[model samples]
Target: MPNRCQRLLAAILLFAAPVHAETLLCHVTYGGETQDLEARPVSSPYTVPVQPIGSYFLFRIVFQKEPADLAAIKLYVFADRDSGPLPIQQATHPYPPLAGKGAGFGFTGLNQVYEPIRDGELQYWCEWSPSSGPAR
Candidate 1:
């Protein structure tokens, strides 16, 4: 009893419904952080913060690759979590206030960090030859 056009349209729509299928995407990692890519590609590189330590000694961190999509940082010289801050701290034992003459607290080596690819919350990390800490 329906018109030809209406019947034809209904038949087309019924056949056009989407079929459900599950696909796995590659997992992504950066500076030691990982996230599931949901069968899709991530559009940006993950970033993390690195703090320098102690002015008493010069500190340096050599990234295997600058702005690496995901990399493993190597720590050379002064092994352990307590040698010296990456940038080297100047010993602010007496956290001097007001004047800039006090020792500046800092970390002293190479570290890895992973930022959460999530919304609303974030993650940060700091690795020092002498010490390490997690920041949220």
Candidate 2:
């Protein structure tokens, strides 16, 4: 009698956990190279690595979901001269079936990042850009 009740309670609790319906994959292209990373669903944004300030990079984002519902992804840009980085620009895009690409505007600074709303791993590298040279 008691064992039967315990089993039923355990089954109910297991099904009560929240589940994510989608997964986002982001790829940062910089210095003629590309980086593939996974994004997390959280409030705080994850900073991705590119070249130093004045350099240019591109982002390739892919959206995958089970039910194929409507969703959106936001990108946050931050920059700094000597002090810490500050938010400069923020842009959001609707998640497409395939993927999307984004680029940093022509600017100069340090610790420049393209942060996503979800969690993702960031990679940094040194490369040359036509718009601006590598950071000093």
Candidate 3:
């Protein structure tokens, strides 16, 4: 009997373990092409390297992780360059019945461009957006 109970407990534990989000999908438009980038988690202010495209000094975008729902993630942005229009964007997800499952939901940033990398530092800043949501 004890053996059977242990087996059941093990099964329950296995299923109860949290399945962390595997990748944070960030979409951006570059040269009219929808580019898909996988975001890596970082400490402090959110930061992600992006491919350079245009003359725009500031970029704003949305990034998301799946298995998530109605909620959004809020954060501030900081870079080696000047990023203005502070007090970064706020939560926009408005589903009253569900909490998001993944990270990077409704995340917005006023990223600074680091174009033309110097001394091994990042030279491009990518701002993810909602239109760039997880899809092909």
Candidate 4:
């Protein structure tokens, strides 16, 4: 009887374990140089930071996991401006992306973003996967 109870408790605990977290990874390129950007689930999109890409563009990514049914990932691109950053483009994808492992969904091909004023070209692609550990 004691062994049966122990097994039942273990089964309950196993089912209650949280799902593994997911990660969004992107490779951004500008002016002959490339850099990697990573984002994890966050409660608030406002907490994410805008990253600079080369001299003319700023990039931002947001991953939301709460309200589980509406989980989503968003990507934003901005053109650097003297007064502030100007929004250029935005992309959103439903969580657990339609693609299977090793295949990521994003702006179809080599996504090219242009800064209206400087005419600078920035390219980027992104993928999502179950978090294995610390980001690279």
lDDT of each: 0.28, 0.39, 0.37, 0.79
Residue-by-residue lDDT tens digits, candidate 4, 30-107: 999998887888998888999999878999998898878768888899988888988999977777665632334343
Q: What is the TM-score of each candidate against the true structure?
A: 0.20, 0.34, 0.29, 0.74
The weakest ten consecutive residues by lDDT in model 1 span: 88-97
After superposing candidate 3, which stretches have Cα over 4 Å from the reference? 1-21, 46-53, 57-136
In candidate 1, stretches whose alpha carbon ends up further than 4 angstroms from where it belongs are 30-136
lDDT (10s digit) by residue, model 1, range 1-136: 9999999999999999754432222122343444332221122223322222221222222333333343333222211134533331221111111222213312222223222221112111222221122111
Clashes per prediction?
A: 18, 2, 10, 0
> How many residue-pair clashes does candidate 2 contain?
2
What global local distance difference test value does model 3 have? Answer: 0.37
Best model per lDDT:
4
Model 1 CA lDDT for position 15: 93
lDDT (C-alpha) at residue 32 in model 1:
43
Best by TM-score: 4
TM-score of 4: 0.74
Please identify which of the two predictions, 2 or 3, would achieve the higher TM-score against the true structure. 2
Q: Choose 1 or 4, whichever is better by lDDT.
A: 4
